[model samples]
Target: MHFLLSMFPSSIHPHLHPHPHPTTFCCRNAVLEDLLEGGTPKPLKTGTTIAGVVFKSGVVLGADTRATSSEVVANKTCTKIHHITPNIYCCGAGTAADTQKTTDLLSSNLSIFSLNSGRKPRVLMAVNILQDMLYRYRGQIGAHLILGGVDCTGHHLYTVGPHGSMSKVPYLAMGSGDLAALGILEDRFKPDMELEEAQLLVRDSIHAGIMSDLGSGNNIDMCVITAQGVEYIRPYQESEYSDQRRRKYKHHPGTTGVLEEEVVPLKLEVVEETVQRMDTL
Candidate 1:
């Protein structure tokens, strides 16, 4: 809750010293005009993509790890989604450094709330506060954020970004893959859908993004927030669909698992080797 801790000595970076304007401007609460005068970063050629959907049980969000520089994917295992609170989570796709810093800011704000209120604020309240904070810093480089969480009241999902804009929806997508993913979501989402159905909707949206968005691919990381708490579902490539894709195109192995699953089967080769080695011992 106590923010602005002196984590390190305030020493100017060697590279930043030359570009004093950008550093000084950002360090202070400069107006948006001063920030945007610098020009927007080219809509990142590469980043992550995220989709969120609401269901009766709660809400679900999914994202993929595919970092691109212009048109080519540079890293296949970048994490686009992260847990911000025990019951709340955020998935994002945008400038990596910006996203991380923004998320950290939000996390600190939430901690402050817990300290001030003596109770966890609801998801919608947190989203509103976060959106306002981002808006206040509108001149600073922005990040696209999709937030999801579950509380005794119900489920919540929202998208926030540019100029402090925020929209709550049954579903939403962001990043280069947003267009394709939105199309998939439009066709599949239904009001009052069940948890399983919602999961499928988000999953398909993520897959469609991977196919269409050059900056998004590799594997998907999903999170489910319900009455129980926040549960993460990682990209699983051991299923029939994964096997089929493996036969057709190569997939980076590291992108295959993010969420801990209910029943992960041990590889037969590894099991056999373990048993044989145990017998010898």
Candidate 2:
């Protein structure tokens, strides 16, 4: 009878099975695993423009506040510039907290080692550090950074993306409005642009971005970082530039017509024929 009972499986067999309990430890800092898989959604704020120009003097970095969430304006005068090293500056446009944390980590790490090293960090070293930090918390949270500075040689600029992708250029911009701003900058930029010209280029680039990106706004804050020191130009209203562009490109299609002298005006019959062919196609 005991042998027959042993051969039969019991309903409570799972309880009789041996299992080990999990050991938990005190978590000293915020763990990414919890934030990602613990069912807690992260809060975020959005809006910013990152534009920079490399001139004979050095690099000029520009960022605007005018952040917007769901087409609603959020904050004005939100800063995006951080001093990674004495000569290097990092500016970004994206999640405000993540970007700020990137700067904070860099600053804290540098300060802790400054006494022993006795040397200011370089832009490349700072960038590698930032890239690794960003790589950790990379999902759905990242910053578009523009790192600019003067090394021992001269002015330099680099655009860095979320996944540690970076590229060097004489000038660089990153944001939703980059395409529009690039159109304006491409036409205006010279190889070795001077300080005054660089200022105008930066302003014009921001102005272009303002027209295209609803999230970017407010008066333009232009900064000149050269061999001398950092100079923050007074903010100027964008409306002034909008009015000027309106005057330049303003055209009345139905009324107050202005025709290009270079093109001979086509008659109504010619226009009708072209429309007929387009319709057929």
Candidate 3:
């Protein structure tokens, strides 16, 4: 894999220099960090929120839909939990272009491997391939992915970072919002979490991240993967979420979810204002 990264010239931007080395993938699609002559870019806001949790039944992956370019929220509804195959899905974080390309690379390789091997590759196999691919690009590509699925090996979850680091974890969160999301998962995640509970847990975790992190929100999308296959839980609208807040405070006041305070647990009454505002809708 190192040999592949070595193949590219040291130059991060292949297009601007017209170097002897063949064009890098980054050349075709420019990265946000590129210093274009005199124009200074707002510190590349690749902030995103992606969470993956492993349970006895299956894996649950979730991400927020806000994509930022500098100060601009580029897309309000970008899909981050990408379908790699029927049994495989990846949660993309970091730079949007790199994440998209990385998933494409993984999906394409898995397809080709399945065609040649006469069988679908397992989750670990896919992770191994992706680790190698990421290793090859290593420092050149800034992308992060939380790969999860139910292969023949049962449920598996892996996080791959641009540094080419791979770690098998039961639950993880990545992106600028990860610090906030990780706090929730650390406090409540369990080995025996049910599918429905896991879905709600992930949703709540994403909300905390979005609430506290500068580049994490707008909407939420979740991908639940079990032996039955993948099921997408659509985005929760602001109105619907506010309504949920009221119900949660009425039904279960102490539990985690949208009602939880951003940094600490607050009185459920704090949400009453938002609930009142929602009445107009």
Candidate 4:
């Protein structure tokens, strides 16, 4: 308190101050610092690159295949794109299991709804369900998703966060590599891009993320949603960053000479025995 008062002009008395002032440092940071000092900090488990775009005729969604847990790469070719319905697809980021189960739940709900209504489910319906579920969880679910689809209304693209916040955008990126991916999307995206062009753009965006972010790599996957149907492409592009082995490490069986061979045999005693069968009533 004295130190804070010293910063003010000596001409004005301390009691003469008009009102109380907020602290200069954030309370959250102070609490975090105390927690860190008390124990070893664990690395957060997160990684992935996912993006979506709305084109003239349909929607294109892209994702990288890498999954990371803290500093370790958990899966090299894991699928991030998930199917919600025939027309709606999602690209998930954050905790792998969380995203997988969340999408599975969405798919199950949408499927049931479609069956009861005798018609296809809308994209907005899926989005609403997802947001409500996420909101109820209060960000504990740890799933960030990019949803894209085509329904009777039209082509749609949305980004849904773990906290239930959502945004409708023509193009959007998510995950640790989102910044890098968004750079590519923002630079070349067009309103009326053709199917092929939109696909290529999405592919490039994911590729950019893979190249720039350690959390995103392995291969690229894409999903295209059109009025006719949905097309899911697993491994739309392979990662060029992976290095091929110069020479095969596997050697022929005879490559190494056998120094010596020893065979041990166990002596066995054989006995013949007969067992009586029991009569059933």
Candidate 5:
């Protein structure tokens, strides 16, 4: 009972047989345990696309407008970007609910820390608190956060893994669609990019994710955190992207339509004979 409780205290089982407590975790975990000991196979939850970059001025964050459940696209307008403090923002990946709960928790902690210290918390301080909390619950809290901000310490970006690992980087991309987006960032991101250029890069990266990764897409939500404050960009609508495609594939100069050439129909008798054969079969 103690061992089981330790595995997932608030989840799994808190009490063994001959006790009154009930199982609180998913039956999937039970099946997983059984499989580890020679039982069966099953599944897991997967979702989102989140990206962040540190430009010459500050940090820029963006994500796709999707929330997913296994193979299903749950919400087309779900946002993965969360603002935890006036100067700080988080790009969430993995479980949406977990990400929301963690960011809200971080916001509360930052508030308390600010009140006690009589000064705003720095980026690292906030990341430290988040990493520590993540380490405590670790696997139970299924959120990977890209924490970015402008602080007295200067502009910064950090990736806090779902399992509590933390690292500072110039830029990062995470979630199911990360691979495609990260490739774009790696190829084109520059250290001297201004806020506007950085936002473009973020949008293009998310666009790449939407094109190649099934779990990502809808609209692109973006924000830039600088010395002044967080600047919110209008979300990129899917209809706009579709318009771009239409413009790209539309008729070019000097090109004539098939109708202009006078499209000729095949014999109607041939079509009727094929339909008659199919009906007889």
Candidate 6:
């Protein structure tokens, strides 16, 4: 025992020393404290629904008109469809500013390219430029877009992601409410659809998104691109949800008896004023 005590400190003697109890402090509270000091994190308000599809002779693009800031609706009628060229149009999602600036930049670049080449820019050309720009930024640009157009090659439809990923499809959808919209598109879409059928499909898809997502509402905008020409519709359809007052709950005067009535009269006092002049040298 003496030898063991001499080898190890008396306070740490194996047999005599008590094992330390596990700490009762919670690590979660510490993390919460640190987060609280920094203030509650705000939810990102980037919400939209944009989609596109290719038909027999043309392509149709659709989008919702609601812009949100957190839980607040910022713009009820904001345009998500952007013009890339006479024949090319884009429907954008994600950050509104990013999509707007990105499409604007692409439009300007395509316009300049057309001027230099003396021919209208191709859909593939626009896709390439957009993918390259987004790739260089490494997904920092929050622009999810659907590019559709009619060119000499044929009608084209492509979905572009913020990370520079691109896909060519007969139909595509993007944004917070994309799942709902895509559900409708996948169910009704068919090969070689007529122009009217394609328009209705696109409209119904957007309506589904609006009905499903609070962030996607207000109205629907569409653009049709064909070899003949382009038709840009500001509001192809209006929202079915409207504020309607069923009945007015107005009450006539003296509907309720006055518990007690009191009236006070105002008193006014008038004072006469005299003007005096002072002489100065």
Query: Roughly what TM-score does model 3 have, to 2 decimal places?
Result: 0.71
Per-residue lDDT for 1-281 in model 1, tens only? 00121222244222223333545445432333344585443443655678999988888889887777777767777777776778889887677766777778787888888898888768887788767666654434447889888765778898888567888888999988889999999998888898788888888898888888667778888888888877787763212233334364667888677787587788665443433344665
User: Model 4 — TM-score against the truth?
Assistant: 0.74
Cα lDDT of all candidates, in order?
0.73, 0.67, 0.80, 0.84, 0.80, 0.85
List ranges where model 3 is wrong by over 4 Å.
1-43, 236-281
How many clashes would you count in candidate 2? 0
Among these predictions, the greatest TM-score belongs to 4
Write candidate 2's Cα lDDT for 1-281 as tens digits: 12222333443222122321121111211232353465434454455666899887788887665767656877666666777766777887877766777787787887766767987566677677766665544333367888887666566788777776778888777777778778877888887778888888887888788778877777677667776666755464334433324345665576666565486787665443433435555
Error (Å) of candidate 4 at residue 251 is 14
RMSD of each: 14.5, 24.2, 18.0, 13.5, 16.2, 17.2
Estimate, for each residue in 61-86, the C-alpha lDDT of model 6 and write its tens digit: 99999999888999999999998999
Error of 1 at 181 (Å): 0.8
Of the two candidates 2 and 6, the one with more favorable lDDT, higher being better, is 6
Q: How far is candidate 4 from the true structure (C-alpha RMSD, Å)?
A: 13.5
Please give the distance, in angstroms, between residue 172's alpha carbon in candidate 4 and its true position after superposition.
Answer: 0.4
Q: Write the per-residue lDDT of candidate 4 for residues 147-241, one digit (tens) a residue.
A: 99988999899989999999899999998888999999999998999999999999998988888888889999999899999889988998776
The parts of candidate 4 lying over 4 Å away from their true place are 1-45, 244-281
Alpha carbon lDDT at 62, candidate 6? 94
Off by over 4 Å in 6: 1-43, 244-281
lDDT, candidate 4, at 66: 91
